[model samples]
Target: MRILLVDDHAIVRTGLRKLLAMVSNAEILEAKTGRESLAIAKAQPLDMIILDLNLPELGGLELLSRLRQFGPAPILVLSMHSEPIYVTRALEAGAQGYMSKNASPDELLTAIRQVSGGGRYIEQEIAQALILQSAVPAASLAQLAPRDLEILRHLAAGRSLSEIAEALGLGYKTIANNCSLIKTKLGVTKTADLLRLALEAGVS
Candidate 1:
């Protein structure tokens, strides 16, 4: 099996590499950035992609959408984010499976096997959360795209618009426009309200 591992952390990639060795004769490829992973996926034939949500240049959900455009390999999101919102968005973006980093190695292997076999998998706890979330009112936060959510998270972390633009590799005007759009979507008129919404959603 040829599996591409996408993560920015070297230590995490090293650990995942060792864990993936359990797959018989598995050939693992590594990428430390979203751009690098997208290039690899476009250039190489891969059986599966194990992706992390936190990435440079591109957010994980956006990367998954682009990968689905041409890359046929099934994507399994292996992320530190275990929130139902994150999980639901990833699956909506084309991930075949979603597993938290806190999952046991055994569960990780199980997710890999299930996804590689053309089946879907979600961490048990996340699946339950999704079910519960469906029983309640869907927040406007759920309407935001992955990048928008990322921007909101940065805002909630106390980043200025310029700082967010630099961190996201975008222009200041673009960030400002996005903030305007986000405000419209959430029915807020001030940055403070956006921050409050982000905090309430646990996006930070």
Candidate 2:
């Protein structure tokens, strides 16, 4: 099987390559950012993709959505963020599996194999957390106003406040106010915390 490994870190790609060598007949392609990953995906026929959530040019969930727009491929997210929110968003964005970077090599091998075989995979802890969250029937995560949602999406895509304002045709002050409101509603004290909350809630 052919796999694409999308991560900014060379060491991470190398480690994954070494681990997968033991489990499957896999030829790996590497890309450092989401833009490069999309270009590579367009040019190659890959059986699966091991993606990192914290990409430089684009967030992993956004990349997953873009990839799905063209075709369906098993995307197994291998990320450092183990929060249930990140896993749920990855899955909702069309990822076939979600595993933490802290996972054992055997666990990653199992995830890759399962996802490549057209099955869904999630870490045991994350899976249990999702199940528990489902039982609570809490308010929707997209509770922000339309402007806040737009800002959240841009933030999730790794855009700065000024960039988001420019892209959305809004004034910098207006965008800042909206962001402040979003943080208040989400009960987050900082942009990074808001991002974490948005990812968990699967806002985009």
Candidate 3:
């Protein structure tokens, strides 16, 4: 199998190349930045791409969206962050699979194989963690409007009310009110509890 290993670290590429080679006769190509990755992918067809989200030049999500235009190769995101927001964003941005860097080597191979086979994979631990966070009543999360959910995600990331307001282009009072309502709907009395709930839900 042919695979592209996109990471900024030379040691990381070397380690991944060695591991991937052991799993299969993979012709692994490495890229240090998003531009190089795109160039190599456009030049020839790749069977899969294992990507790191914290790239140097280009943003990982933007690169992911652009890579979707190149071909049908599944993009497997290998990230250090197991936060809900990170996982959610990667999947939402078109990742075929998501695995935390802390995953076992065997799990890594399984995720790659599943993604290559046109199936989705999420690290078992991460999946279970997210599931447990979903212990809120049935449709409890479903009750949230998309905007409220988005706000919740920002909150879980430790963003201040003003920061979230600025980022969302809403007023401070508006965001404060929204947070109040979110806390009420979530049945949490404290800001910390709301944030904890959001994190449990894999918001970040």
Candidate 4:
């Protein structure tokens, strides 16, 4: 099997290459950013992709969407954040599997094989959490107001507050006030933290 690994950290790529070496006869290709990964993917045939969610240039999720435009190769999201929300969003965005960086070697191997073989893979704990969340009635979207929801969604998509305000035709102070209300309702301390939580929850 051939796999492409995309991450900004060379150490992570090296470590994953070593681990993968122990289990399968896989040909590995590495790229340090989303643009490089896309270039490599377009130039070569790959059975699967191991992608890190937090990237320097284009984010893993955005890259996943772009990759889907070209082909249907299974993507296994390897993220440091284990929140079920993030896992769910990746899957929703066309990822075949979601696994954390903290996973054991065996777990990583299993996920790679599972995804490469056309199967879905998610950690058991995350799966259970998703199930529980599904059972609960989702909060009404009206609670936050449409404008606030729009700002939150842009934030979830990695837009800065200034960018969000400009995009939405709102004043900076107005957007900032809406953001404060969002934080109060969501119980988030900072905008970045709130965005992370929103991503994990698949809000956008």
Best model per TM-score: 1
Clashing pairs in 3: 84-202, 85-203, 85-204
Residue 29 of model 3, lDDT score:
92
All candidates' TM-scores? 0.93, 0.73, 0.67, 0.70
| lDDT values, one for every candidate | 0.86, 0.77, 0.81, 0.77
Query: Can you write out model 1's per-residue Cα lDDT over 57-152, one digit (the tens) per residue?
Result: 888888889988766799999998887777878898899999999999999999999999999999898788778764222376878988898888
The whole-model C-alpha lDDT of candidate 3 against the native structure comes to 0.81
Model 4 scores a TM of: 0.70
Better of 1 and 2 by TM-score: 1
170-192: candidate 2 lDDT, tens digit per residue: 78998899888887887778888
- By TM-score, the better pick of 2 and 4 is 2
Model 4, C-alpha of 59: deviation from truth (Å): 1.1
Residue 38 displacement in candidate 2 (angstroms): 0.4
What are the per-residue Cα lDDT tens digits for candidate 3 across 79-191? 87786555666787789999988999999989999999899999988787666654453245555654676677678778899898876667999989998898889888899
Ten consecutive residues with minimal summed lDDT in candidate 4?
134-143
For 1-204, candidate 4 gives per-residue lDDT tens digits of 788999999999999999989887789999998889999889877888999977655666677878777677899999886655456557877999988887787888898889999999997666776777742213423245435545766787778878977766668898898898888887777878777655545566
**Selected candidate, larger lDDT, 2 vs 3:** 3
Q: How high is the lDDT of residue 83 in model 3?
A: 63
TM-score of 2: 0.73
